[model samples]
Target: MSDAVEGGARRRGRDETEEERADRMWQELIQEVRVAQMGVQILFGFLLTVVFTEKYDDLTNTDQTIYLVTVVLGACATGALIGPVSLHRIVSGRRVKPQAVRLASRLTLLGLALLLATTTASLLLILRVATHNGFVPYLVAGVVGWYLLCWLVLPLWTRYRHTSE
Candidate 1:
């Protein structure tokens, strides 16, 4: 809130201009997106092949529905994760880096959330098909809890504990 201006441009703790900050943030976001994008793309690719497998026909109706939903979620996550690259390509040299960065960040977050849902659904379908046991939901819940702890809770806690603003 107390950022000061230098050479007519407001400076943050890093003393960088708005353009510099946007560039730095854009690089970091792209790196993060690359990692997530690769994983999601691979997952989505595999999900696409599921229907061609012989085992797919053996799945119960509910399992088939789950599989369908998982594949759709995975596709959506892939699109969202890749959206920043497309956005950057289309908006390059437009002097809208800051706005683009904000939109890309939001897309990345949405992609991550969708990825979680897709993975959870896939796991549920796989376990149900593989085990056909009663404790599958409990097992899936535990794994989901682990994912939430690792993906969401710890990051939030760290941010809350260490962030000054």
Candidate 2:
């Protein structure tokens, strides 16, 4: 096994060139984005019809506001997740895959954050509507905490523990 060192820093295991690495990263990113994009699009589609539902008028003003905010968040998440595809389409053959990949990765991260917010808001609204209990906020908070642990904390911890920079 050979460990290549560059610029006084240890190189990662992959031996691919920049372009090859970018190509591989782009494919992986797109595959991940496809799954997220589909879910976001479906959630957004459902959100779009919420306002027209007869029960919509029965919601309290607070709940209605939550729904509106959730819809907007979902829309933003959808856009960010889909942005990479458009970015790739416009930048193809431009010899900017590396830069595009970085930008797309940022967009994907932003999309995930937005998705977290959208999901949290939706969960809050649903729980408030379904339970009508005083513990709804606590329940939502607990679930959001679980999501933060599962989606963000664990991944960052694993990366920090297992990888060197």
Candidate 3:
């Protein structure tokens, strides 16, 4: 057990070996991934079914292209979100939980970024189809801004603001 410093202060709950820290981080990351994975899976499933709907054929060429891109992004995001489980299963009993946790965290972050892009693309397609307004892009951008604020900015802000000066 040892103290770890961050921004000049010893981080709380730092009294753990590498393995124990990795185990704790793995548990926490899995819990977080569960929520995100479910959302991505559900969204990807819905996207998969959209092509079979009768209304899909009425989409403009541009809209169809956007839909295609959105669906691909959704699939990629789902893969990244679900990657940690597969990674863990394969790496189990290999004495690599710490490295595994690091890689899984990276995958989760990439998944989140992809999810954000997919959501933005989906909203743009839907709003364009529904309203056909010139302002659709702006509206979609605003929603993306809101998502960024909620998902990343607030957390980063809290982390920065609370850190020792």
| Model 3: pairs clashing at backbone N, Cα or C within 3 Å | none
| CA deviation > 4 Å runs, candidate 1 | 1-12
Higher TM-score: candidate 1 or 2?
Answer: 2
- Clash number by candidate, in order: 0, 0, 0
- Best-to-worst ranking by TM-score: 2, 1, 3
Q: Highest TM-score among the candidates is held by which one?
A: 2
Worst 10 residues of 3 by lDDT: 8-17
- Give residue 37's error in model 1 in angstroms: 0.7
Pairs that collide, model 2: none
**Candidate 1 residue lDDT tens string, 1-165:** 368888999765776799999999999999999999988988899999999999999888999999999999999999999999999999999999999999999999999999999889989988998899999999999999999999999999998997766
lDDT of each: 0.94, 0.94, 0.94
Q: Give the CA lDDT, 0 to 100, for residue 100 in model 1.
A: 100
lDDT of 2 by residue, 41-134 (tens): 9888999998999999999999999999999999999999999999999999999999999999999999999999999999999889898999
- My TM-score estimates for the predictions, one after another, are 0.91, 0.92, 0.91
Which regions of candidate 3 deviate over 4 angstroms? 1-11
